[model samples]
Target chain A: MKILVLMKMVPDIVEELEVASDGRSLDQEYLRFIVNERDEYALEQALLLKDGLGATVTVVAPDAPEVDDVLYTARAKGADRLIKVTGLPAGSGARATAAALAVTLPAIEGALPADLVLSGCQAIDDLDGFVAPLLAGALGVPYLGLVSRVSVDAAAGKAQVMKEFAGGVMGRFEVSLPALLGIQGCEKPPRYVPVAKVRAAIGAGGIEAVEASAGTAVAPVEVAALAKPEAAGHAEMLEGSAQDVAEKVADILAARGLL
Target chain B: MAGNVWIVAESWKGSISDATYEALALGRELADGLGVRLEAVLLGHGARAAAASLGRADGVLYVDHPALADGVGEETSRALAALAAARGPGLILVPTTNVSWDLLGLLPARLEAPLVNFCREAVVSGGGVEFTSLLYGGKMAATVGAGAGPVVVAVLPGVRPAEAGKGGAAPAVEEVVADFVVGGGVRWLEYEEPEAGDVDITQQDFLVAVGRGISNEANVEVAEELAAALGGAVCGSRPVIDQGWLPLVRQVGKSGATVKPRFYVAAGISGAPEHTEGMKDAELIVAVNMDPSAPIFSVAHYGIVEDATDVLEALAEAVRKRKG
Candidate 1:
């Protein structure tokens, strides 16, 4: 089985995110990016499948700041191929990224078409977890998302995937190969790869790059302004013992007739 | 963008979802603003009878098909696309949900239309709809201008009240029969309910929502005692549920249950956006954590910087004393 994992970098929320002076985009100065939380989980899932059923794992990503480090880390973590697609329209939303990937992925040289594609259900930046399904639509394949568990029967050209629904409902689905899934999580926590291993992967020669052909035509919504949500209220710090805070909370609740 | 405003009415497990009504409430205002009709596209199997509940919509486009029951994105998007292609809607609003999130991605690609996702609000501006979406979870909000074409907006929860969309004259129902062709691949097999049943956290009046700060399974008893004293139930953030400290039903987060109880006591949660999305609207929030900079304080009405267990124990005592 050949599995392709799509990953990307998003603003690290721990650092304060600032709106650009233009007010339409995020301020890039003094910003940091981390591998999207769930995409790392998708890579872990693909690697687990590789360890069990012997599949070749390829990590694909749209070009972004510090993405090369994320790609090298994926290789260190057992991904077999790393291909970065560049020249995507800067400042595009997740929809454009998905559209561009749909158009550009199939055109990459030496990267065989994948039987199954896995990507984080959504990025922290866009919070639009539709990349897998959008790409699948363009590729004319079936897609399932919010998947947590997966097992492939390569001989039969089929896969069994477990999806998560609201209220913790788990729906199992069977899909033919050449499918894509937006992974919500893996069966296990993502394994940590030491920095030494990632450095070795970089020494082994960094990732391959694919130039996005000019004028990829996915119409993206233009952000007119960006700002932090107005803080509704701040906590009135109830200091002293727990009983003091609890007493104050209970009094507040009682005042509101909730007690 | 020059037609009626349409909302994809989401029905699941044989009933209309609250999120659907919420979208309807928003759609009604947008339609009125645009001086066009508000329509609902209801797709389900044997679910056509529920159309009467969608009276806020000016018209109901109900389509019943066995394939529509499972909410497979391709089938749903195809069915909606076929109908929209024929009837030219100026704006479409879909609630961003598990049932419809897949199509939020698929429909835009197939229609070649721009999708505004994570959308929180939309208003009439310059004779067009401009949207505001919460990006990077909820840290940053972006205003999106609708370009010169029909656009689909995925409305977020908590924008408009579902109550406003509940009562209206029965809408005219038009049964739509459209072709829903899909790749013969993905098929829903079985559904596993969460750990039989515990408590429907969504219905709770008071919630003691613990996070990773609780530490271990044994510590859950501390929360239970606190909840008992407060005459409420115990719930947790995703980490506590993922750790098996609480059942999935007791989880309060984006993927779990959204709760706006009368009183919420948060402990040890760093307030990730996913978790905050579910419970930020609680009537009153009291947070306890050691970290001074924990984001939970941002939404909390009261806070105590202390160990969760120590605080929980004291809170229980205080509540017990107050009740006694």
Candidate 2:
């Protein structure tokens, strides 16, 4: 089985976000980029699947010199090959990315026909949480989203996916081969890849290129004008000595039945 | 006028969601911008009553049936598609929720319209709407344009406050029937409500959020104590929600309800932006963390570099003394 993990580069949220002069856009100058949080899990999940099934793992992402480190990181995590698609815009939304992939997937099929595709449920940046299904539609393959568990049967050409619903509900689904899946969490936190392995992969790079859709234009749903949220109301300092504070806290907890 | 603004009201188990009102408010804004009528297409049981209360919109069309008491994705697509054709609107808005997320992409496919998922903002331009969405994980804003046809947008819940509608008398409830079919692949097994704590934080004007810095689940007592003393609610970070320590509804973040309380105090929360965005609209932000480097301080109007357990104890005592 061959698996592909789709990754998107996003701005690091730890950094402060500056609104554009118009207050409708983000100021790019203050932006620092990293792999989207959910996409990181997607890549990690793909690598785990590769290890479990003795299959190959491939990563496809927008090509940028800055993202060379990102592709290397994927290789360190267990991807066998990395394919880069050029001319995709930075910080593009799910519709644009899915639309582009819908066009690009056919070109790469000759070298690597992906048996399965994986992505994070939602990227931390956009968090619209719709890309996985949209990509599945573009690929004309059965897909599942918000998956907590996934398994593949290479012989039967089938895959079982367990998805998450509200209030701790779980739904199980089965789909045939050449399908797409989105994963949410891990029983174990993702394994971190060492920088040394990533550097080695980059040095030995044999990167391949692919085509992407000419970008489509998006319409505004509303103009986003951001203001820093107002300050919280005054907190009355808990009075008295340390013991008094603790006692008051305990009494309050007991009254609330928290104690 | 450019086009009628349309809202797809979502329903589950025969009842509509509170976010539906937020979507209507957003739709009304779009419609007002274009100087066109704002219309809503409600699909599900009791939809007519919910539609009746939305006096803010131009009109409300209902597609009520027993089949909709349970969630029906495919049927919703048919109803929305038919409504779009009849309305001939320039833009359509739907609440971004679990059900809507499942049905969002299908609408564009069904109506042959351009669908933009999770729109954060929009502006009317040249009879079309230009929308802004945070892409690549909230790092940068991506702007897109829809062509001449209706631009369908799914909006994140809790982004805007509910507002009064300015057009056509509260929408008259009218039922529309269609050849709608529910996909049979999935069936309802059972329903169990999450174990909700005694308090609903969303209803609280005062909220005390405990972060990882709190000593342990046991130390949640200190936070809860503070909540009790102040007559507020106790909330937690993703870990608390993920651990099932609290109901999923109580979680505050990008996926959870965007909240705006009069007073929001953070104890030990390092305040990841993912977490902060949910409470950014709060009236006041008081952050108490031992680590001065914690990100919560940046957004906090008042910051105290002290342990959360200690601050919570102190604040709780102080409030109690004041009340006594």
Candidate 3:
């Protein structure tokens, strides 16, 4: 079985974000980029499928300085191949990215025996959570989102997937092969790869670059402005010793009749 | 030609969800601003009655089908696409729920329309709609404008007052028989609830929730003791549940149970949008986290920037002292 994983690099927002002078985008000069949180989970899910079913894993990601390290790390962590698509404009929305992937994934040599495609359920940067479904629509395959578990029946050419619904309910469904799944999490935490192995994999140099064709399609949505949400600023910060804060909390609870 | 603004009402188990009313409230504002008719589209088995509940809408496009009742994404998207093609609504508002997310993902591609998900606010501007979406998990907000007409938006639930549209005459219902196929590769088997814990957190009057910042499973007892002292239940964010520190029933987040407890204390959660979406509606929120910039602070009524473990220990101790 051949499985493809779509990963992305996003701005690490641990620090405070500064809106650009244009008021429509983030300032890139001081920003640091890292692999998206859930995309790591996606890679892990793909590797799990690889281990269980003896499938070949190919990882694909948009080009960025951080993308190289992510790709190298994927290679060290059992991914068989890495393809970096370059030349796409910055700030490309989820739909455009999905469109490019749908076009580019099929054209790569030796990438085609792909029976399943997995992507992170949502990118912290976009948060639209539409890429996988859009990719499935572009590829004309069934789409499943927020999937937590996946198992394949290679002999029957189908897969059983489990997804979480509202109200803490779980639904299991079967879909034919060559489907796309937006992975939310896996059964286990993603395995860790040490830095030395990733460096050695980088030295081995199996990374391939594909120039993404320009002008696929413009994103329907255009950013009008970007701003920090107005802070509520009403929070009464309880200061002093931990015991004092705790006393204040207990008093509030008592006043509310919760105790 | 200007088109009507349509709010797609989400129905579950033969009733319209609160999210649908929220959409109606938002749609009324946008439609009135654009000088267009605000309509609602309901698609589910026995959805007409639910459609009639949307009195704020000028009209209701009702599609009754069993396949829609369970909300199979593909079928629902196809049905909505068919309705969009026929009616040509300028802006289609859907609630940001699991089903709507799935349907919106496919519908945009099928209709080749732009979709903005998790929007907190929207406005009509220059023959199009501008949407404000929370990004970086609500750290920053971005205002995006879609081009021209026929754009779909997924509005964040609980942002609008559902009561704004409460008092009005029943909307005129128009039955729409759109052409779409229902069954194919995907089939829903059954709904299995998460394992039940000793207390149902959803119905709790007060809750003390923990997150990964609590460090490990052993620290969960600190939260439980505090809850016990306060006569409340203990819940945790997804990671805590995933770590086996708490059962799925005690999990609070998008995939978990949404709660509106009278008092909520969030200890150590970094306030990811998924976790906040479920508990932000509590009457009062108290946040304890080492990071002062944690998004939970944005919605918190009171905050303490301190080590969560230290706060938990002190709170538990204070509760014990109060009981004594």
Q: TM-scores for all candidates?
A: 0.90, 0.72, 0.94
Q: Write the residue-wise lDDT of candidate 1 on A1-259 in tens digits.
A: 8899999877876677888899877788968888887898899989999999998998988788889899999999999999988876334566667767876777786455788899888875663336777778778888888888999999999999988778888888898988888888776768889999999999997588888654344566777788886555678899887777777877887788865
Name the Cα RMSD for model 1: 3.0
Candidate 1 residues B213-252, lDDT tens each? 8777787888899898877899998767655677677878
Evaluate model 3 with DockQ and give the value. 0.63
Q: Write the per-residue lDDT of candidate 2 for residues A86-205, one digit (tens) a residue.
A: 877665656677777777767676533688888777665443225676676666665656665677788988777666554344555666778777767544446777888878888888
**If both were scored by TM-score, which would come out higher, candidate 1 or candidate 3?**
3
Q: What is the C-alpha local distance difference test score of candidate 3?
A: 0.82
Candidate 3 ranges beyond 4 A from true positions: A127-129, B66-69, B125-128, B165-167, B181-184, B242-244
Residue B136 CA displacement from its true place in model 1, Å: 1.2
**Candidate 2 per-residue lDDT over residues B78-150, each given as its tens digit:** 5677777776877778876655655575566556566666566667777667776544333345565656767
Top-scoring candidate (TM-score): 3
Q: What is the lDDT of residue B73 in candidate 3?
A: 82
Per-residue lDDT value at B8 in model 3: 86
Considering the two chains of model 2, state its CAPRI-style docking category.
incorrect
- In the range B72-148, model 3's lDDT, one tens digit per residue, is 78788888898898878888888887756678778887777888776888877775677888888777888887776
Q: Of 1 and 2, which scores higher on TM-score?
A: 1
**CA lDDT of A193 in candidate 2?**
73
Query: Which ten residues in a row are the worst by lDDT in model 2 chain A?
Result: A227-236
What are the lDDT scores of the predictions, listed in order?
0.81, 0.66, 0.82
